[model samples]
Target chain A: MTDTALHTNSRSPGVIVLRWGLFLILGLFALFYLMPLFVMLTTSLKSLEEIRTGSLVALPREVTFEAWRTAWSGACTGIQCEGLRPYFWNSVILAIPAVAISTILGAMNGYVIAQWKFKGANFVFSLLLFGCFIPFQVVLLPMARMLGLLGIAGTIPGLIFVHVIYGLGFTTLFFRNYYVTIPAELVKAAKVDGAGFFRIFWSIFLPLSLPIIVVTIIWQFTQIWNDFLFGVSFSQAGTQPVTVALNNIVNSTTGVKEYNVDMAAAIIAALPTLLVYVVAGKYFIRGLTAGSVKG
Target chain B: MAPILDIKNLYKSYGTVEILKDINVAIEPGDFLVLVGPSGCGKSTLLNCIAGLEPITSGSIAIGGKDMTHVSPKDRDIAMVFQSYALYPTMSVAKNITFGMKVRGVDQETQDRKLKEVAHQLQITDYLNRRPGQLSGGQRQRVAMGRALVRDPKLFLFDEPLSNLDAKLRVEMRAEIKKLHHNLGATMVYVTHDQIEAMTLATKIVVLKGGIVQQIGSPSEIYNRPANLFVADFMGSPAMNLIPAKTKRNGTGMLIEIERAGGEIITLHDHHTESLPENVIIGVRPEDIAEAGFRAGEDVQEAECLVDMVEHAGADTYVVSHLGGRNVTARLHAETSAHPGEALKLAFDLSKVSYFAPDTGERLN
Candidate 1:
């Protein structure tokens, strides 16, 4: 191995040192970033006594599934002992519909803004982009009043609506930037081939949109699933999302603080997003850079 | 029969910016009409207007004796091949060819049969199952053509279809397209900025500049008797040389006087004497000038000039010399031995020369 390394090492000493220096810096940064996640995983697997007595970075002496079970079914959140299972399901119901609806709307909006342009299309798009910049707190009061007027102020449907409304700005921006990279000639060719607006979108634009669709779905899924602001403000106790329930469980002032249960619950709330990143993480970068590069 | 396509006084504008003005074109059946111009000359704009892709600010368009000024592109019965070969990227070759038919609700059997026929004709049968991204540039161009061919529309439009191919492929595809036009005998309206393509493929050429039509004529007529200076200079390779001269009556005929280097004046008798302009520009093609003693005739005039440069192009050697204080190029036979900085006698074919008014650039005779 040493002889092979010597044979293959044709680069000069200065370049080799620079390369190793870069890897060293990047390796240190990655370790720093992974430290908190490592602690969270080990802490969730340990007992409350071990968490209090052991070093924060040490691996668990005896791994157990009790904290996971307790976090899933037995932990208390403000007057109920039922754990994060119900709120986890609430997040599921809220996120799925919100992601699907907002993504479809964003695709349509992108198609119109990119291809079927009209007189005030730029003005309208600029107005839509402004939604991405505004502070979420500024809209809380009006959104609350509007939800009350709609008679769904503290319901799961209201929370879904809130997430979809807020998510459109980002989804549209992603899709618009992506679709803009497609040549306008394709749309023209489709038009000459007898495809109308909806037909073109369904046949031509939709099939080529898989990359951007993945981008939008992942973005909206993560944003809505982890959202605590609207989840807490727009929904009442029964329909509160996982993020709000997890917050209540960890910060409750009644009993001894169960750091193990809190860590397990936090990991549970974050599991879906983590799984998505691990599974489709390669597609995430690919989709974000889809139209920016040309063949 | 009436013309297959007719555009009458068409005008297109975007707010205050006029993109095309007073455009008039009439294409007969089986005629290959080419719109040739420089970039931003509204050639592509006119083609899009005919295809109903762009709404005209004024005037009307008629195809197959039907007024279609406001008709949608699909209903207008026209097929277009874009410069980019805009095949549906997600679709296979077969699907790309049949997409229009499928959208028009053609039966499945008919779509399959048409797709097969077009695929076979374009020699893309092997690539039927492959998507456009998997194909090379030439294969993709064939697929684009197949998509247009399957429709059998009233008119065929090509928007710089060969501009994206490599030079060798462009030449091959150019010949193939010409042969296809010949075999189909279909009316085609082609747009390109290539003068060679226009000269070789067009039955009628419309030259445009800055959103206005300059002239419309056959390739030979446009090459031989261009209506204005822009057409003359824009239509040929290496360009025709325009030499400034003065014409006056000498005995009962007109004599044109041209000044050379070292203040020497040379006189040539003009064939047309009546109403000749006082100050004129003489336009001579490079082929009309030859090395002296090679094709000497009674009408040819000889002039002694210093050869500035010699370029050998295998078939012909181009010799550049000073005439009227401007570098004038002359095409000589390949066998001619010409060298720079040497005084060589060259013959001018006066019988074929054209005289134009210097001020207006209009042909005088």
Candidate 2:
């Protein structure tokens, strides 16, 4: 008899029970984690009366697109009365440039710290890593003043600038740690192959950076898109990001509380980040664990 | 022809700690120079310095008589194969072999031609489209060689390229590398901690220890006449057996007196004019020692000793015995009858022995 057959024949009843028990515990945790998202979807689909009287977990009796349309165009956010559409665009405009600039800059920083090491490179890296630990609230006043001096205060560019600066610490840390796992000999090999600094990064290192880039982009996109603090602090009503707009819509005192519209708007504001996670979640997890394992 | 590579008074240091001290080596057009030593011996550091990857603290490097001390590695016209076979992980084998050419703006036609040639030479054409991650260790190593071969650079630097391979594959690749060198007649400087690789592949071996060049010579020169005790001990498999002995004057010749077990004194005579030191080490290769009745010759001196252990290794048996209060190994013919605790007669070829000063570890004669 084969070893495989022998191993299969030796399975104990306790092992099967343990496996089923593990699945049961994990299934419970997954359902608990997804409960909020389920509640939001159901609430967004319900009419005002159904949402007011129905239990939070109950399925919508009559799903309607009216709330979605109102959330998309008719809702009020800070006297504008136009919904999250404009602010969603604002978040996009803010996040694309911010994520691009920060990720590129972080990749370059990581390359330098990992490959072109010098006497004080580690010290510089350590100092930069200290930025990741600093609370963003601590830098608010200084950043506002700096943005004011730069003549971009309360503008879209100002928000992008703020996000990039704040995001750089984490992005750089991620890229640096990931790039450190790559052998320094690769850089040496490229140099010997007549590849200069930028050329090597573009041809050699950049192609190998797909996993980390996906990781950094997804991280920065979610952080910037969902950011209420920086958006409210950096930009005023016209240029405010979606997160700030969503907050304004839910808390506006002048209008009657449209709970269904608010839930729909909240869902709208979260869709992009959700979409990103749904589309590239595998790459995200892979990137998170890329350099952790020794190759 | 002018030397293909020249390093003069090269010194590399990190802050206050020196890694390489005034290393000087000049290689001709087709010389295979192997920089070999134990770990932390700075062999890799020196290779990097030569490749222009590490900046030399002082002194200058020249390739084909062009000074390259301050030149960036890209413009230095050198190619290197790393021990990890640092092929670009994401690129296919074809792309990897052509990356250097692409960076230099070599046309696609020439790139294809050179790629095919290198792939064919390294027997990696079948794997041209596969990524480095998919290739086995030996195959990845060949791809690395293909990348370097496509460059056709003035000098090739190999940093322990075969150290990652299995022992069987390492032996195979070592021969293939030698064959490649014979075909190209390229100037190559390889760094490895494996002395067998150094002895087998290097036309000239530079033995290093503690970041200092211990000795530099041809393989035979290094083996037959090592510059110091370190090189003598390092270059051979099983290593040369160093028996500490006392040297004295015997008429016009010199005599080395070694004490065996049971108060047995064995004296060997050497003809040398230098003043004899009191305490010295007598270095003899393990293979030079044999059974007394086996391969007896004029220079062979027989000594009766107790065999402490015997290890059979197919064709030959390694017999361990006590000499001068230390274990000495002898490679005896497999057919010889020997066992532990048995009295045995061993022959030492005096002509093949080396003398060293015990205190300084320097070769005395």
Predicted structure with the largest TM-score when compared to the true one: 1
Top DockQ model: 1
TM-score of chain B of 1: 0.97
Tens digits of per-residue lDDT for model 2, A105-161: 999999899888878999999998998899889999999999999999999999888
CA deviation > 4 Å runs, candidate 2 = A1-39, A49-61, A253-255, B271-274
lDDT per residue (tens digit) for residues A107-197 in model 1: 9998899888999988888988999999999999999999999998999989988888998888888888888889999999999999999
Instruction: Quote the positional error of residue B219 for candidate 2 in Å.
Output: 1.1
Evaluate candidate 2 and give its CAPRI docking class based on DockQ: high
In the range B1-365, model 1's lDDT, one tens digit per residue, is: 99999999999998999989999999899999999999999999999999999999999999999999999999999999999999999998999999999999999999999988888888999989999999999999999999999999889999999999999999999999999999889899999999999999999999999899999999998888888788888988778888999888877678888898874788887654667878988888898888888867766888887899999989999999988877899999997778998889988888677778888888887
Q: Candidate 2, residues B1-365: lDDT per residue as tens digits?
A: 88899989999998899999989999999999999999999999999998888889999999989999999888888899999888998889999999999989999999999999998888898979999889899999999999999999999999999999999999999999999999999989999999999999999999999888999899999999988999999999878999999888878677889998885698877765347688889999989999987767667888888999999988999999999888899999888789899999898887878888888999877
| CA error at residue A107 for candidate 2, angstroms | 1.6
Runs of candidate 1 exceeding 4 Å displacement:
A1-28, A52-55, B296-298
Task: Please give each candidate's TM-score.
Answer: 0.96, 0.94
Q: Number of clashing residue pairs in every model?
A: 0, 0
